[model samples]
Target: MSVFIEKKKRLSNDSISQLEDELEDNPLDYNKWIKLIKQVMVKDKEEQIRNVFTKYLDIFKLDGEQWCKYINFEIGKGDFKKVEELFAKCITTVDNVELFRLYVSYVRRVNDVITGGEKARSTVISAFEFSVNRVGIDVKSGELWNDYSEFLKSWTPSQSWEKQQKIDLIRKLYKKLLVIPTEKVESMWSTYTKWENEVNSSTASRFIADKSAEFMEARAWNIEWNNITDKSLSRKVLPYGLDDSDKDNRKEIEQQLQYWYKWIEFESRNNLNLKDDDLLNKRIEYVYKQAIVSLPFVPELWYRYNQFLMNGPSTEDSNSLNMNIDILSQGLILNPKSYLLSFQLSELYEKETNLAKANEVINNLVNKLIQDHSQIIKQIEEINDKSIVKTQNINGDADNMDEDDVNKPKPGYFLSEHDIKSLKDLKLTEKELSRNITLVYTKLMMTNKRSSGIKESRQIFKQAKKFANIGFELYVENALMEYYSDNKKTANKVFELGLKTYGTNGKYLLAYLDYLIMVNEIESIKVLFEVSITNLLKEIEDPEGVDDMDTPVWIKNENLEKINNHKYFIKRLIKKYGKFATKFLDLGIVTSLEKRFKKYFPEDDELELFRSRYSYDSIDLIKYDLGKSVKYIEQDTRGDIDQFFDYDDETFDKNKRRKLDLPSKPKETAVANQPVIETQNGFIGESIYNLLRILPSASYYGNVEDHVFNSKKLVELFNSLDDIRNQ
Candidate 1:
């Protein structure tokens, strides 16, 4: 044993040395740095651990996990002052709920050790105040508040004045916590009421008066909560924590149901009188009805609705019972495979002293499931036989026919032989249908309360395993059933089988990951992460290709969908694990994956703009008004021209008019000598002679006299043309 330990220690030291050398060359390798820190931690050398963490954090200050580990290490050393100092630094550095939670937990531990001393009390109080200020608005702040209240409750003041002060502070804290819109609002209120009840027993009238005001405040706050939820619902705002990018309408509706459920619970807990009870019941029913309308197939809502009716004041009424039955019937009709409602119906019948009816319901359900299962099996056999016979016939026909004859066009629609064959293959195969039937049978048997339900369920599970093409959902269900039945080892084995079978599938891998997380199997999580990332990348690399001509439209679409789902899963993994996902992040693959994500699941406009700034051209100039008009000129017409002239008419007088000293009378030429008639089109065209003139020195100049002469000559020329035209 000592030799083995020495060998393991040597290996650890060697690994640390290698990582240190690697880090010296590539200092920013996050994983290498983390590995070195973990190696140092295993040695339990406080100074070495501190130095390594300090060095890594000095370079990578934003690493929350490293900061947390540093603080936790100090905490483990039981050095409260150092822990506090570390927390103070970390709270400023990392804006995370986990850090605040750790601080609160540390303060609570210190207070427990020191009991009621002034210093300990002040320290705990100040820490609680700081945590509340830091993370009060977080959804999980309820835990912090609960811990604070518990800490305050544990304080035992020696004097009456001190006790009063403590009570006042606790009440103030509770009042503040009550107003926050957290999912745990109800729990906070419950704690506050319990505290108030204890105070009321001690000082009756004073406590009542104080609580009257607090209760009023709480009532107002609850009304505010109602208004906020109503407005959000009206605006179609998704519930907090649900991903809007997923575009899952059912999930959004289900989240809304959660909100409604909480609201109903709040109202039920706060009802004080007949009027309040009536109002609360009415609101609950309205919300329940609304939820069911949107999510008719959700069995939980139906179950809740039925429970509410049964537990209400009308429970003794036969009509109320009938109403519950009717709701369950509707739920069962909408979701025939929902064993929950079926079991509930049977239980209700038994509660009413109708064991016969209860048994009848269970037996009928079991018989129907068994009959369906048998029929499916028979159909599968028939399909197999038909397929075999058909294949043999095709083989025989092919053998008898020549190649040309075999290739000859068959009399059919526009589909080619390959397309027809693909279409024929698109249906769910016999094996798949058989597995689905077995799954349904297993579910029914599991829900049934008969003597042989467990035995039958196990048998169905075994039968399901016989089919090679069983769905991932079936495997998951079987594993979960085993886990719930306390057969955890078997459940784990089932999950292993599933991973072995569908290792390339993200759905099964993610389901298994979730189960591991739930079970806190950290080592298995790491191993699975490594395996899943490699397999997922390979699947993304070599996706199934569907030939456009031969593949059915649905099959092609399903393949495309699978590819997109793989991309989404990869992105989700990166987001969940951050630097741990580095092993999977080949630069090429990441770039392509990001492009695919952007194409399929685009972010909001602002986010996309920020991300795509370097990749695409920006809209530097956005026009908000009508743009300038385009000028269209005729081919022979001159384009728009602005004319400018100098005023020098005297230049025209110095230049002799170079009149074409032609014949005095009109002469015919090859070109028609149309009379020089000027049309007054819009503004009359300015004569070139008036605009400029030739000086006696043979330079062009314009003066006032020249302008006047050209203007008078143009008028006379026009008058002469008009008179000649009239003649």
Candidate 2:
């Protein structure tokens, strides 16, 4: 109960009316009474403070403390008129400068004064002048005459000081200082330096420079007016640290300074005229010497100087060329990996047809480019986090947030673990792709030159093509990881990312087919050709939309139209693979069908006729004993021989009787089924025709030995025949 009631304590007057009578006689007495009341309030004597103020208010009748307290009560009640009246009364009685300042501030804060605050302040100033003049102690007048004019100039007489007008006034004053006589500018510099050297004055001067209302403008004045010499400006600006904040602005300013500095130096060397040719040469030589001496490592400057020398008329240009080369040589000695200088030197050597040296330089450049690309790839790898699981807490201020949350950050993307790994692996794979592709492009380029090296270049191209294929495989994998499934933006980004990762790859064109799939944009035949097999399969669901219909086109127009181009593309691939397979066959056990046919068939007969008969579709033609046919043809000296007959089978006998109506030929009939034929002269015969007749026929029977032996012998004999024809 005591605690509850203690919170509701209100004013209880104990002291009496005598203090108010004294205050009425002297207004200073009221100030003293308020001061004592404040002291009681500070010491937690709140009850006493309230009692004295309340009792004095009743006694004075005019209520001086009550009048002051009314401002607070009025403000609390939002009563503007009562607040204004109490403020005016308080300000009139306020003798202390601090207290009067507080009263004016309060009046302004509430915006309830008699007039505008500025007009009220002016009235107070006039009244202050009158009262102080009468008393003969003018504080404001004395303050106005102080030695420091800076503070007075920047000082605000009204509350409107924060307005742009005041800021503009400060800016104008500083800019005006820039127009002062050059001597005054010099004097200011001397004064600044002197103050900066003194321990106590140094800090004060810096503080003034920083806190001055127009600091930036003043510094600009120093630069524009006082900075006549570079050395002087540099020294003056050292304390300012001109490159502190805005680097681009600083760079622009520095570029202008550098240009002017170079111009001045040029004028000094040439004596301000280009009329004298000898003097111009001297000036050029002087600048060249300076560049070589001052910037020994700047290849661009050296290159420029060399170009100028080459264009000049003097014989010394030749010497200059040599000197330029020598300088680069020296520079290269110091920095061997300077690609620009090396490239320049390589150009010089190549101009003289020194391709070996040029190639060496090119190789160096390629190595450096590769190294830089490798470093970038490594940096990208380092930044990509590859963790799988993460935990998170609900609260934002979760200090005990689970490690799993940190590990598995809320993804900006949707991708499975396999997808993430595939994407990461794809990035590294691109570097390999780029490097291999570059080598391939280089090899292909070398094939352009007509020289003895053409064969070697062709081999290089072959190797390049081999590696190009491998690179394409990796590139396709990367594109799939980028474009497939959730977070498919990876696919869209694959173009730019692949370029950065693998440079200008033909494979990127293939990768973009994934984008076409997601957006249903795969209408172009060209788009279909570039797509990988997997990408092509992805589009297989919509058979009527894609280019590669599984069935041929005349069967189904819409499906054929969709995949008309894809069928052609697949056919092309088959042709290519077929051609590729021949290489292995040519090098291995299988004789090319063309080689085998050429070996047995007569050169006089049309090859097409033989080809048709030997073709895979002509199974019945192939079923005939090729060896027997060859032997029979070799023995036929005349076109038609009745001796050529096979009467071994009833079918042959019947067909022959019907077609030829031949008489019984017993000897020929007996020779027909025999594996080896004997002549009437008792000649035992194993002829070339016999070998041809038996081998291929045996091969047709799935006799594995005939395939093994005949194919080898056919290629060997065909190769010999080609050699003889060439000779």
- Superposed on all Cα atoms, the candidates' RMSDs to the truth, in angstroms, are 34.8, 39.0
Maximum-TM-score candidate? 1
Tens digit of lDDT per residue, candidate 2, span 252-299? 445434543453354345432336676556545444533333333344
Off by over 4 Å in 2: 1-271, 274-278, 292-298, 314-321, 331-339, 380-727
Q: What's each prediction's TM-score?
A: 0.30, 0.26
* lDDT, candidate 1, at 13: 71
State, as a TM-score between 0 and 1, how close model 2 is to the true structure. 0.26
